[model samples]
Target: MKKRTPKPLVAKKLIQPIPEKVEPIQTEKIENVYPLNQMIEKIKTDIGHSPDVIIRELKIGSKRVFDAAAVFIDGLANKDVIQKVLQNLLVDVRETELCEQAEITDLIKNFSLATGELQVLSDTPIDFNQLYDAVMSGDTILLFDGSPVAFKIGSKGWESRGIEEPSSEQNVRGPKDGFTENIRTNTALIRRRIIDKNLVFEPIKIGKRSKTEMTITYIKDLANEKIVNEVRERLSKIEIDAILESGYVESMIQDETYSPFPTVYNTERPDAVVGGLYEGRIAILVDGTPFVLVVPALFIHFMQSSEDYYQRADISTLIRLLRVGTFLLSLLTPAAYIAVTTFHQEMLPTTLLISLTAQREGVPFPAFIEALFMEVTFEILREAGIRMPRAVGAAISIVGALVLGQAAVEAGLVSATMVIVVSLTAISSFVTPKFNLAISVRMVRFIFMGLAASFGLFGIIIGLLVLIAHLCSLRSFGVPYLLPFAPFVLKDQKDGIIRLSLWSMTTRPKLIGGQDNVREKTAKPSP
Candidate 1:
């Protein structure tokens, strides 16, 4: 028999193929008028008969001619508001004469429901989706017998954290109040700062199951329409089961997924958000999260603090320069040290080199391993401090770092010089104003360290070039990440590395702010 040819083995798929999108199930509408009992039962069935779903039945009018019932969630709807609504229907309706001439539905909506704002769900065929959504979202639903429509009373109330000074973005002198978990409260805070009628908060609903409330806030004239539309389009495309935090939305809507740098800016401070808005950027406020997300973030935006604009221009400029220096120091210090000690020992002074050599003489590992060990230890300590309870977290981190450094040096696992370098690197990383940016730096620092260990100074220079190219290529919602530096706009340079005097810097960012870029035309003030 002829020798059989060997057959090749095929690899099986590790991931299952994604299923095609399924059409949403169409819910049947409640055609015609539903009786009071039937409507209440239908609602209870749809929303589930939980203990929190309260349905109270009562008679309307003096003669009890009409049957009525009120449905609301227990904790979601304000008890005081629900009580007032019931009083109007029970006591107030009793006082009014029962007349067939006046429609009971109109009478209840016009006089009986004494609430701030309400919507009438009047359709030829009642839509149960609206009814269910209203009931679940802290609205009181009023059902009347023989009425084709239902009354949706706005009674949204829930316990939430009150406004306090933001812990993360604290400044020496600025607005003390910050954004709260309540979306309405956050919008109010923004509105209080900017009284302009042109400032609009357009509402949108996201998340299939959670039905999270979100708003796209921007100044109509100042913000570029294209950017606003782009933001809306991106947000509308997010199809998720739930949006528990702003970060979820940020990750979904951001332009770059693989880049270490943050394309979107998030903050708890309302002033920071308002400041972005003034610069023609858009702010997205998510319900139940104090942190709001600002879009079209540039590289310089993360480095500059809200405090920069609040202080004297000279002082702010100096501080910003210092921050820039610290940022570089944090990113390159470890890599520089590793490169110098490993391959470029000649770069150091004779005495410094002698000291470093003496310090490293007792250590067994090479420069790369020593630095990596110390960096990883510091990262663990930092993470522990953050995750631990606040009362002892700072103490634990401080004592842990000092004790571990001492023990490691004594044991010769790492050298004294390596410990000092790591300490300086950690301290410099904290100088970055934005936590997200700082995290990006922390992550990139390791790559640079690895590069330095491989090819010394040449590897570091190549890495820096690649990093700059990557940053220049990044686009945040269609705007360049390095807005002024890459494009080299002379007018916008005032706010780029160094912030010029407020009056001297007359225009908003060229690409971000729309054509109406003249922020102020005032001449420089003279002493």
Candidate 2:
């Protein structure tokens, strides 16, 4: 009976309940903060008794209005700075206008606080947030206990290496001051060289977690806007957990992630980064890393050093050619050996071929096997040598080289020729200025060696084609990785592979795909 009654009456309409419009809770603003003392007390309370943010009360004469305190990070701020600024504020500040009270800053600097020098307003002008930021950043903060605002005077005294010649990129003649981890010092070092108002240092904060301070140094009219935009865009696109060093930024902003070639080049020389800026490219400097990043970097740039331009053109040209040759050798030597021994034996002269065969006669493995074994062993030893203490690294490298080669040859594990080939390959990889570039080449060298072993000359061709295709596809800040070449720009060719006479390179590279194409107006050739 109950079921029959329900069936006759129940008509259910599907209805969803709408969420009630809750009035947004408004945050209450501080209607009126206490006078300096009360506000300071409130700040102290909020600080929850942190050791670094200290408050000390000191009396000045009979007025007793002069209450001052210092705020700074424990390690970042110097005691001498705190003592100097505080001492100056208390006793040195002269009342220039004869107003009993004067602004705090005038006294500390060349002038004492004048009558009109310091004025208090209902609205605090000096950014407390910014001042606190500077304080946290190794700066000293002077808070006049009575004043609503605090003055943050920079007292960042950090210990770093004296300007020394870059060990990585040694030069014969030039400023020996390589960049240090201190950004201000590095910027100052660069500014010392470029006595121009156009040299602007634009700072940007990056890294969501690291919050690393990065600077974009560029000449006003010299740097192309398109490239600048590209650089900024790529950097903005970087979403990472941290950027501890310049390498982290380099990895994030490179043109091609998978390509063996490097799209962004790094240097320790301030002149080099400045030179890149002059060329209308963007340069990035990270706070903790001395290495600076240069974008729109071309393949030819790595073959060059700051010393190259400093030296005679002829000598520089020769050295640059040697570098290029070394790069080729490093990437191809092991592969060439495998190719010749496996299938291209006719390419070698009869005597050399006979000598190689003689060494290989007792070897149990094929040429590919021998080369791979030697190459891997050398890579392991090289890595260990690098990781070991510097004092013993050289010794380890020497011993490792000798033992790996001699033992392998004697054991019939690898041919003596293979040992020589792999060893030469390892040495040649260092010709590139950047260690990252050299590392990438080292990795690809093995791939080419593998290809060569499988199909000899054919394998080498395929491997090179793959590399070229990948490079051509890569773009660094919108510039092609194989730029000014591969695509074959005849005008920009003057600067690639070989550096031409100064006048000959009057025109800037186009495939750099920059907004500005001219390095100079009329072709004034370098004699």
Candidate 3:
């Protein structure tokens, strides 16, 4: 279903008295507008030498006309298109003459040199608001003297990176084309996926000031009507000037804005967004971002990837299990080590405990200090690895982690066992598909680590309880964040922790605010 905004928002109404009559949007005013010429001059003054806008004066019928021009940032309006368009206009004026009965209609309709048109639009009215949209979209406006309406010619041109494999999502097999910063191209990608007429995308200009177009796509009959309304309402509530990325949308409309766990899921894969829409979720495509946002999100979404379904079901199940295992390991492994070593040494094998004690013989710090130091160092190295250039990322990660571990043990600043545990935790944190969820798990890991370091096993258990409670109480666009688990939906569990064969998994996850229920039909039932 196509939505004018993102997924639905939580329903909560507040009663407040309405204010007095507010001024309507000034979409057609040249009166108060910073003149096109003035704005261009200011842009040149503010931005060094090059900017997107251009101005040209050309003679027509022995009179020179002053026109304002603009193209998107590095967009399609280059020298070639501009030259072809202008030269054609200068030479072909005699041919564009209207017939006695045809009047202005033929001139307007057939005036386009390219797939679009180029004509004298000399009627109606224009405001700054309308001009703002034209400017952002890279249309050149011709405002003639003594005319109320300005002509907005569609001649957008610029260069952008072709749709290629998304860096964040690399599939072993599937289409490689991912979304780009261009909103139209992204919409086209989705349109190619769902040829069904029901797959709708409503473009909404958000950013009260910047007016960036945010495309909201959904399957009409599949998505819940109530949820769609909620999404539109939330998007309309935004009061910012500009939105550069989907993360901006996230921070603005997220259900739990302060929480580390993301309420909405994001992906760079068209297949993922298509899958989401098929399952009745909404996909929000921002104008200048490749990170397409999907919702209403669940806790389990972060643990999944489209590859799971693409691969054999058995492999997919194993992958899911690994993610869950890593989730636990990333959160509790280092803490578990600290707890056992500090308060429950008897639990460890005698030889193992003795070996660990022997290794820590000359170390000045206790078990907690050693674990904390290694964990902190490992995190720093992980950050450095990510920030480094792509070519050096692997080398930095391997060398920084391995060298740190070896040096810490050799220096007796940390025990060999502690280094191994921290290393394992760091390794496990990278297993999940969703970076947001992984970071959330990493953040919670420190809290558990601190607890285990202070009060041993008991504290770790308490920390787990608190974490679970918070997750259980959470919501995503009004749907329970930890649904199926907290609500105990037996039917939904088939597709939750394990991969039920595609044949068996025939329903969407309940209460995601989706409209569609069926996912498949019985293919050939065995008697």
Candidate 4:
């Protein structure tokens, strides 16, 4: 039999050609420069002539010689700033002699504009992209009829929710101010806390269509330059159309994408970001998001609270220990219950075993199903409470949980002991300070529950081993997820698991802080 040659494989055409390199926005200078009238028309057309966009034509430099226009968005640009610019150009310029040959751009930039923050778009031909970005970002733009240059005055203003106590990260003894949606306000809050000149806020604009503003802030002297550069590189690689929230940037720049655990830490408290910055961590603040992302976040960081540093060392240590214990309880309680009741009934004492057995007597399902049903029900009620309207949300959650749990117990669908276990677990889960970490625990709980159901107590141990291994392998911007624990940094022990006295923590975390790790050099205080 003659073996026929295999048919030649057909090469398939790709739907889209992949570019070898993705370029960052605003890199290339726009060469197309149009005259004043044509530029105004282009702006109107490009911006779809939105009613909110206001363009007021006026003459500048006395004698109405130099024709100019003030362009800005009505709501975004501060009305006062626009008025000040108009006054300077329209009213203030009248006193000066009309000069046709004088440098009007220089005159307006130097002597006319009252704003503190202003930028000259260009000396020669104005970059339209920069001009468009300026107007869109709430800056009032000044255009001249004959000159190619333009002025971008910092006039960003929009109605934003005032800085209020963060609902999610409330503390009894710490500052009440939290980060607002405005990026500038958030940076100011941080700056207020740390007035050092070394503290830096490097700005960059991301997203193609959204052109969302972002800042990567870190102390130049303390932050590890390698980590900062890694963060910068990752962010630069992002080529998205829009970044609606900090979460978008977090998802793009995080080290572990598929892991259930969050590699990036986010919080609404400005104090928290300040603390992270002091610890040599870089914070990524995105415009329009109250939650700021802190990088190279460790497992211990999530377990800690800003209040920890505010309170006495002993009290904070005790509270932190309680939190760690409760976290374990929340993760292991249901799984332990399932394993003991299903496979190792011998592990329970005679009296408690008999009581649990009696409770399960009326229940039709196995221990695993009973626990799973109650946990899921509680989670549903919790989600409902959060999503529902504020006035009715809490009432609905409480009423729903009580009614559902009581009804289920009465109907013999779940054991009373199972309900108690689930309630304890849910309450314990809330003890976790970081919402993202709590969510990770919640998701891991189910896996442990499944493992317990299949292979009993042995399965739980195996699951925990795998979980720890996974966490050990994770990194947040090159820093280990379980820093100071897996790496065993003795110096960082002062602030890990339990925080020592403030003076005792003389150095920052070895892996995170650069060579300049000495935080303080004072001796311990004593009376």
Candidate 5:
């Protein structure tokens, strides 16, 4: 027993294995050979032997020391530029004999390739990775035999939609030309409006797979430095696979992820972008989407229209008031109907209450349910209209809504007053100048209706307070979302909620307009 106890008294120590030091793996660098034939074979292998890639092989120089090839994608590159380069190397060079002592590279580069904008990659040949990008971007690449170099020739011509008026943001007065899907064409439209030397269009490529091109357009002197840097920083941080449209970027960089409100504004009209730029906000234009995103969007900005500034101040002010009034109505009408009918019937006038009560007498559902039924049906009809063929969408939407509402009322599924209320709400939602804001209001209305059904007007009040609190907490690239309202900047109010005369709005938006807030002198015209 003593020997067993002594053996059991020994303590066991834990043994830890030493961690291995891992070395970083090196990637193999693919280099092009001196012969043009090898480079062509390598390209064919690299691009997976795609049939769309056109590789036109031809001979160059008097002795044909360099057997050259022009490579480009069939649909992307301009056939004219490719043919011209070939004519210069093959046909044009044969007409004039190359100097016996002259270097072929210099003779071809200086004399033959001088017609178009050409870039010679003499520094260890063109990287195949870069060559793929060039060809995909509609540029032609010329590789030569016995030369470790290639020429990237500009041949970026493809069919694109011509400049047309924006259908969404139509105005009574302004430039008819809107932004096109082509980025360069979009930038040119902005440049035509803002002729100032300080205007800058900085290009960047986002989306790993799509490689979508985006341009950040802003006035250097007028835009705040911090805002511009923040814009660039957020864009650089985007690591998505593809950006199919401007809305994708908007959803990515927006501050409030859960809120229904849009922190970033988008418009197809070039004037709207130019207007945003002049206010010291940065405009982001994405290729292949007509909508351009404008940052630092204020709540008041969504209530405004491109037509607001085009007319007399009095007229714009009236229209803006109507929009604001309708916006509130759209958001509250259905909820108010629910609250009064379910919880506050005494609030309505005696005659109106009698009429509503009589209409709802045979209805099977409660007030909230009736309102919800009509609203959902209207939404379905609207979506169907939008998804249907454009030629018949409008007609279908109008007929569908009319027939459904009338049938619902006749069947005693909902009260006639409830039908009228939902229809009015739907129409009022369209009064909002910006569709994004209108959509936000549409979503928020549902929440309000739920609240009203649960706790009457008190619930609606709580929802509003919560909404305002959330908006106050939100920002667009560090600028407050509820500008000139929550913080209450008096100077910015001249353009907020109402339109003043053009001369009266001499100062740009106080927060984003940088130190140069004064857009121009506030000199009033003397009659």
Candidate 6:
């Protein structure tokens, strides 16, 4: 008999398209010719009667020949300046004998309005979207009865937190000022340090519903054009309906989505962002978020701090070495412990092995299980400390850790040595300068523990090899993640794991600093 033919498997159900109701945005097209009353009604209809949107109607010219209106968000626009503009326009218009729309505009431009930033929209009705955005962003809009264009007066003023020292990126010698939730203030913080003509802040709006503002800051001659364009393109391609913070943009533009490491670096310190910009990097500033993102971040950047450059070269180098050491300890300590006690007991000294064995004699679980339990408990304590209120967070974290560790050891649930190992690992993890990288290390540690539990030190060796290969394979906006060290550029080593004197460091990172790598050629100080 002939072999029966196999039947093709049919899908159980057909995939259906998502149902959506998309209304046309009224602001997309120009409003047809309408009288002043109709325009005012249209504005009201477009943006509901929110108590904050102030619309004040007033008569213009001494004879009251023209009816005019001013519209702005209540708290966002500067009331003092808006009142002054109205006063100057109304009182000064009496002196001009012109009634034509063009004549009135010329008079306003030449003498009527006292404001230095008076802009004419056009002789035709503008799109409601443009009008809405300008008003919402704190600018005052003026509409006249006969004129086709509206006047946009610059009067952006609102309460914002003043500059203060960043809690995350602290330093003893660097500037104390940090980026604020306000995008303008954040850009000004960077501008204060980089006072050059080449410094450019390119603005873009993201989010359909939120209409959030963002700026791409970079030095024209210093930054590589390819990196800048790549950054811009990635940001523009984001089609999300809301971008609340820099993290949203960071996650969207990252090179490796699945990797544990962060490709985009974020910091609250202006000095840090400026330092990155000097090295041919671009900064992304998001409105309403204090943290700003720097692009093409290197793996070493997570280990180095802005304070490193401020300290003496010798001290900086020593501290950098210590951090690197701690990073290795944090990542490998638990796995090494599990591997050694479980599969390589001979590698330990006789006295230490006996002591460890004695400590584990009363413990119920194996070394790997003991270590895993402690690490997870420590992570829970850490998360609780962060989520809890500042007033009680510290006390709770400290007492909880002490109580839990003491109770677990006494209960024979975990060994004392395992507790100490877990504590040391937690302490070492905090040494990383970048919080994102620290999180990545925390996640990767669990994987390493599992590998060590299964295949001993050989499993850990395999894990490290795979980890190194992944790091080498990762790129941050076309720049190698493990740059300078992986590729081994000799000149760039001046500021790698160990930094040399600032004067000796004449050029920026070779890969980042396009054609103009030389930062300073003749500025090396000598005795």
TM-score top scorer: 1
What is the model-wide C-alpha lDDT for candidate 3?
0.73
lDDT of 6: 0.86
- The lDDT values for all models are 0.87, 0.71, 0.73, 0.86, 0.83, 0.86
Q: Which 10-residue window of candidate 5 scores lowest in summed lDDT?
A: 6-15
Error of 6 at 45 (Å): 1.6
How well does candidate 3 score on lDDT at residue 163? 88
Point out where model 4 deviates above 4 Å: 1-35, 61-64, 95-101, 123-126
Q: Compare candidates 2 and 5 on lDDT and give the better one.
A: 5
User: Tens-digit lDDT track for model 4 on 1-527?
Assistant: 98665311111220122346534323333234434566677777777889999999986643335668989998999999888879887777643442233466666776778889887776544566778788889999988765667788899989999989999987899999999999999999999999999999899999999999999999999999999999999999999999999999988888888899998999999989999999899999999989999988889999999999999999999999999999999999999999999999998899999999998898989888888899999999999999999999999999998999999999999988888899999999999999999999999999999999999999999999999999999998888899899989888888888789998788888989876889778788989
lDDT, candidate 4, at 431: 93
lDDT of 1 by residue, 44-138 (tens): 67776789999989876654346778888998989999999898888887434533445677677777688888888887567888778898888
> What TM value does model 4 have?
0.92
Provide the lowest-lDDT 10-residue window in model 4: 7-16
Clash pairs of candidate 5? none
Clashes of 1: 0
Model 2 residue pairs with clashes: 97-115, 503-525, 503-526
lDDT of 2 by residue, 1-527 (tens): 54332111001221112235423222221223223454455455545667877554443322223455666667777667666655655676433443234344333334532222223223343345455456566776555543444555666775766777787887777768799888888899878877988787888878766678899887777777787777788788888777889988888887677677788889999989877776777789899988999888877777778777676667778888888889999999988888888898899999998998898889888887777778788888888988999999989989989987888778888887777777788888877777877888888988999899889999999988988878778777777677678678888766666667776667666744245566665565458
TM-score for all models, in order of appearance: 0.93, 0.83, 0.84, 0.92, 0.92, 0.93
Where does candidate 2 stray beyond 4 Å? 1-32, 35-56, 93-132, 144-147, 239-242, 346-351, 511-527
On lDDT, the candidate that comes out on top is 1
